[model samples]
Target: MAASNVAAPLSSQRPLAIEARGLVKDFDGTRAVDGVDISVPEGAIYGILGPNGAGKTTTLRMLLGIIDPDAGVRRVFGHDRPHEIGRLIGYLPEERGLYPAMKSVEAIAFMGALRGLPLAEGRKRGLELLERHDLGYAAERQIRQLSKGMAQTVQLLGTLVHRPRLVVLDEPFSGLDAINQGKLEGLIRTLADDGVTVIFSTHVIHHAERLCEGVAIIAGGKVPYAGSVEAARDRIPAQVRLETRMREGAWTHALPEDARREGDFFYFSLPETGVEPLLKTLIEGEAGILSLSIERAGLHDAFVAIAGEAAARQLEADQAGGGA
Candidate 1:
């Protein structure tokens, strides 16, 4: 299936926490976000994935009401956005924000208060969250004194301290190390498990695959694919890689329709008919098939296949214009 045909569920008929229709954004005569629509169901961990400059951030900004869309309708928790957004959502922008001179605990509590949390409860929750994220020891440390990773953690904690119904995180794992990355992933999952609708943007496709139940892959200012992770994987052809200890003269041409050689192994796409025939053919051909298993397409492969197609189309259009 083509990426462009991958459809997201409709918000109007579904119990959605976030919805946008015909979203459009223009910057200096260029369409940054073009007629995009998004629907995030309640309690879902949703991902907005794309390459750099693919309008993923722009769409997110518009959704958060940080920037206005030139055209479209948007709602958060069924409330009109940019207006009622304050009551329905929490946002952690790609650019981290914290007052440099403020202590970590003070900053987090202040952020929670800004989101409508009472000072006492906000301070208590702020301390708890900081401890949960392993930033408790740094609570008294000023923002400027903390390392980059520590600062980012403080900002993330602030976003979640208010416990808003919807959370929009832009590149939440941008600068974290492996340990911190795992920690953030855990927090994201925990939030979703608690019934918070999460809409996060990232260039790291693997994180989306691991953390989100559904994802929207955007390219060239449009959503080329959007659906459940399983559905996305299903759209791509399933293949298998086989490693064998066959003699040097063994022939593998008798393999399945999409079979090819990569070093000593044979790679082939599994036909809907099954794997028995392919295995039998290899055995009959005197190929020593040591191990064989189906190779599932990873999110990286899916992104490459979908985004590459869009880029090719754009190149073709540009060339045609040049010729004209």
Candidate 2:
């Protein structure tokens, strides 16, 4: 699909938790982010998706005030200066770290402290959170003593310790096993259920597709599409899949011009005239319609269509390089 076709700005009635316009950033002499515009609705699970080296991190950093944009304007929770509202936001950068010697509960408390939560309250909340999430056993263990997934979970718990209104996680699913990934997904849902605006960056489309209501598709530092997932998928029509008893018949004429057969099944885009007329034509033409199914295109298909084959290949190559 052409970029223009999917470029319609997403409109939401909810107040925006984060908004940026024409965000441009440069590092040294290289342009890392160019003309990125993002709008995240309050309490929505939004996603920033791009392949590695596509400036996802740079864009996120600029929004969080860790780095300044060379050209752009951004407002976080209505504040012109994002850092001024640091206590109201929780961020987990791609580069993960902790004081390895600190116990899990203490580490969570320390992170909370950095965000202005008192030590005693942070520790109390940290223990309660750990116990609530079935991590009480690891609460007293030092970070170095836990498994990688356990440590990552600890860090994530720390991100939530202060109970910020917005949470930003960069490549959070990285280095997690399937079980832990499922747990993280549940945690994200729970956060959103509690009305937290959760925005996460990931190259993995499945993660975003399953959890995000809105998404920004960034490639080579440019946002080609940013809108509701439904709008993105609707760029292409729903697909029709059919199986007939016979491969050749008059019914074939009713099939779309682009329809193709693979063994016994034929597939094509759903006809604009509607399936009822097509079915009538097929039945009258003696087409043995064994079964039929029509389904909306998934986010994976939509991503390929919107971002183009080259961008899809870039994502595949990056995932392969990184062991995803």
Model 2 gets an lDDT of 0.90
Tens-digit lDDT string for candidate 2 (232-288): 888889999999877888778878998999888999999888899999988888788
Scored by TM-score, the top model is: 2
RMSD of each: 5.9, 1.8
User: Candidate 1, residues 1-44: lDDT per residue as tens digits?
Assistant: 33554574523344888788888999999999988877889999
Residue pairs in candidate 1 whose N, alpha carbon or C atoms collide under 3 angstroms:
none
Model 1 is weakest, by summed lDDT over 10 consecutive residues, at 315-324
Candidate 1 stretches with Cα past 4 Å from truth are 1-5, 8-14, 243-254, 262-264, 277-289, 309-324
Give the candidate number with the greatest lDDT.
2
Kindly provide the TM-score of model 1 when superposed on the true structure, using C-alpha atoms: 0.85
